[model samples]
Target chain A: MNQTTETSPRPLSARIGGGILLTAAIAIAVEASTFEVAFLTDPVGPKALPLLVAAILAAGGLAQLFRPDIDVAWPESAVLTRMAGAAGSFVGYAVVLPYVGFFLSTTAVVTALSLLYGGPPLKGTLAAAALSGALWLLFVSVLGLPLPIGDLWMR
Target chain B: MDALTHLISGFAIALQPLNLGLAFVGVFVGTFVGMLPGIGPINAIAILIPVTFAAGLPPESALILLTGIYYGSQYGNSISTILLNVPGTASAVVTAIDGHAMTKAGRGGPALAMSAIASFFGGTVSIFALVLFAPVLAGWAIRFGPAEYFALMVFAFSALSSFSGGSLMRGLAATAFGLFLATVGLDPNSAIPRFTFGSLQLLDGMDFVVVTIGLFAVSEVIQLLEDTEGGQAAAVGYGRVMISAKEFAETGWTMVRGSVIGFLVGVLPGAGGTIASFLAYSTEERINGANGTFGEGDIRGVAAPEAANNAAANGAMIPLLTLGVPGSGTTAVLLGAMLGLGVTPGPLLITEQPDLFWGLAASMYIGNIFLLMLNLPLVGFFVKALTLPRWFLIPGVAALAFVAVYAVNGSSFDLVMMTGFGVVGYLMRKFSFPLAPVILGLVLGPLMEKSLRRAMALSGGDWRILFDSPIAITLWVLALASLLAPALIARKGVPAE
Candidate 1:
């Protein structure tokens, strides 16, 4: 059923994404099949919907893997680097958030991003400080929502 | 008269200081995000959902804040469309045609004025229609049983999928992926874990807020980072921001007609603002195409589309409130928000939660008034926000998104999950898989499964029970019809009026 339709040189990227989806689908299906009960309670239990999802996903992934859209635009390395930096910083923020707390961590992340987005360091730093301070005050004091007070600050 | 009384009480709830302030903040932020090129209402609402929840506002107030963001963005979209020619979403693309042209002709101020005016006309008129139609639809929907509701959800999925843009297969794939995500937590009925993979956080399922933010907001940052060519800053109003009486006279009927058309179109499943504006523009062009300079800098062109798009935006809300089905991606997010707030929208929603239904309706009016107030006299202030370095604006929003995700579960793992979903989202955007259907599927999957099983259980596991009623049958036909609509309409060429 595979069609030789894909004309793009980097069609492997499409296949990779599709393969990931296919793998996820197969894994979900396999996991769902093991769900058991003392007796079948419903005509179609929870397994049915997921199995259907897996089937659809498998078909879709196969379709995509076999015949990828050709006009996929890949970003240049420079732009790709910036995107990676932004994503990496986000992950780093996630990693350090609990330890660094909402305030300092937020300031650090925002400042880094501002610089990445092309802000002067001084302006970025000030904006980050202001943003973090304002968010801390609004969420904590005004709204009375609890955000983590950094361990660093507490010590 | 009864509707009026209900609406008056809605106004009372809406008039409370906190609710009012939330509405103002919602619209203000909505307009700001809506005007920004890369960010749209979906991202804006996604970014705010966690914050609103953390604030511990009553569900109704949170709903009010979110719905404000919904239509508020409609008003805000015009600012960039007219000034910078970068319409935030496909809905505003038509507006940019005449809107940007008018700017070039030194009529940017009046163009902005007419857009706000037309949008206000659309917003208010559609809200009035919503008050009228929503109750009637809800009353009719109260008769719907599980089978009909199931069929209706199917119709929703199909309609959304067919209109999910580009490939039907890709949309289906995205939708299936969303359904798979929906199955991640423990199965509500069987009490069995489906795909948690032995993680504690997976027990409660993926939070829609985190998923939505990851899918829309976080991915957007990655996409923006990849874009080398940035938009030029929009010039503030050059001429009078207020349009002349002559200009109003010229476009008065166009605005009214566009509002009517937009509202009608918006009420249909998947026929959203993009179609509404396009329809309104074409209709107006047909009517006055003889003498009017239709394309290049015509104020009526701006009025027609802006009115239709805003009206359509409000019109789309009707189904979300009354039928528990959303007509567009934005409304899908709204539906998700409403569901998260513990409001299951359906026929009984009006009777069950009059405050939410009427309060939201009333607040739309209040929100439109605020949009008018903010956009007309204060257009200059909002425009200045555009001049702020993109570096600052994008990152700041990204930080807000991060904080919002962290606030959801107070876990770094969720942030990691958000990051992972961001990558998935970025890939989905690249592969042209429509993101909204994934959301619709994720939100509606449980309901779909529940209705399916309930229908079967009611009939002793007879699957044919799903088609027992005429309503169910009709809905099934409509579901199939929706998938066939684009093709049929394309072939028939939108038959003569």
Candidate 2:
């Protein structure tokens, strides 16, 4: 079995693409193993589809290993840092959502992302907050969709 | 007499003030969504599904709006392609060849006008074809059995994988990944949750809206963040939006033929607008080899693919509306919208819901007319949008995406889920693991599984029953060929244009 290439000397696009295929292959294997447990129930239950999917994924993974062509450029350090910051902002939004409400949390996250992407601080923050507030009103008030309105502040 | 009468009745429904208004909104939003780099038609359809649902529009009206956006975005995509050299969607990739070249040559005005004219030609022509062909396909499909449908779906999967470029194996894997994502929630036939890990949210399986938003829109935000030193597209001088009569006369037939071929190919599952444009452009290139300027700012080159892609966009609607089987990502979103609107669009739909079918068909004609009118006069206004700096546009789009995602579930948790999918989407893009299949799998997965189980039960567990009917056999063969043909052909051929 040709082991999936973890790192590539080629462009960043190829390396990233290869890495993803590897991750996908591994994820499928894990999902497939979980699916095997379903066989203990109904004889022809849900497991068969997962197993078939796993086999197809494996075949595709093997194909990539053999004849990879698309080149993936590895992201620069600053880009990686920005991506991490974006992720962090998302997590922060989730954590603060209930306490602060959708408006505050989303504004904070969007502003954080804009800053990470090199937007000027004051302008980005204002734009982010304004956008978040506009969406909250539009979805909640006009559309009648229920959104968390923060027990702490709204009450 | 027959066609005109039907078309007039269609206009009755389409020209209803409310329906006309909705169609306008759909195309207007579609153009904006398509102009943004990385957020394609799929994202627009998926994001808007819930909003339309919440608005409580009638099923036919809702469909009119959604379907309008579906094809309208195809026209919107070229704005960016010509101005920025960034093909926002796969179908527009061909447009960039001569489009950007024209811009660099300072003929941006002519290129922009030609794109609009070609698009208008493609749209009008295909809607006529749709008017002619839809009922015929529906009539034939009505005779098909569940077994035939199961096989047809397999063909759809195979064709998509084969045509997805790079390696067939990788495409199949991407398809499999999509199918796997589809299996995440609950089995439709059996109520047991398959991959949900006991979460109530998974009970609905994967929401196509959530997944699509995560995959396309959210991932785009991450990409924008990475390109810190992003390049802004120089806005071209707003010249004449009208194509000179001579120019239109030169490529008029090419546009007609391209539209015909593109519409037909687009009706099939797997090969969608992307293939249609590629096929049309290559065919035009071949036919006009010497006389044609070909790649070097050939007006025919622009006209053919632009017309074909637009026609193909309308063509893909046939399977989605008539058969309830979606062959592409955007159509998959449309199907989801249909289901959400409580309209089951299938073989029986034509006979059972003639008004819906005829009304949607009519609305499309009106939508195209509106698109032509909207695109030409307002081309300058939309082109001016390109002048906005990247730092502003990218972050602003991301903010809107975040709100759209948040709008769906009204929970920050969905935002988190969206972010996770964004990362996955970015990886999928980087790896060339065809994102469309994931969507195809997610949308078609339940249907495929239900068909499989039903076929098995009918035959008392005989697997061969799937291949029993001639139609089934043919589809299976096509599916197998779709899986193999790309590897054999693409392995040694020129890189995908």
Q: After superposing candidate 2 on the true structure, give the runs of residues whose Cα lies further than 4 Å from its correct spot.
A: A1-44, A63-70, B1-6, B491-497
| Model 1 C-alpha lDDT per residue in residues B407-463, reported as the tens digit of each score | 787788888888888888988887778888888888888888888988877888788
Worst 10 residues of 1 chain A by lDDT: A1-10
Model 2 C-alpha lDDT per residue in residues B1-497, reported as the tens digit of each score: 66567678778888899999999999988887778776668877777777787777999999999977876677778888887787878788898898878777777778877887788788888888888877788888886777888888778787877776656666777788888988887665556577677787767777777788888887878766656654466656645666688988998888998998888888887757888898898888888878977777887878988989888888888888778888877888788778877898888887788778888988988888888888878878787776766656666677666666666766666777778888888877766677777788888888887777777777766788888877788888888876766556566784542
> Local error of candidate 2 at B319, Å?
1.5
Q: Please provide TM-scores, in order, for all candidate models, with all chains considered together.
A: 0.94, 0.93
- Candidate 1: what's its TM-score on chain B? 0.95
Evaluate all candidate structures by whole-model CA lDDT and list the values in order. Answer: 0.83, 0.77
lDDT, model 2, position B30: 85
Docking class of 2: acceptable
Give model 2's TM-score versus the native structure: 0.93
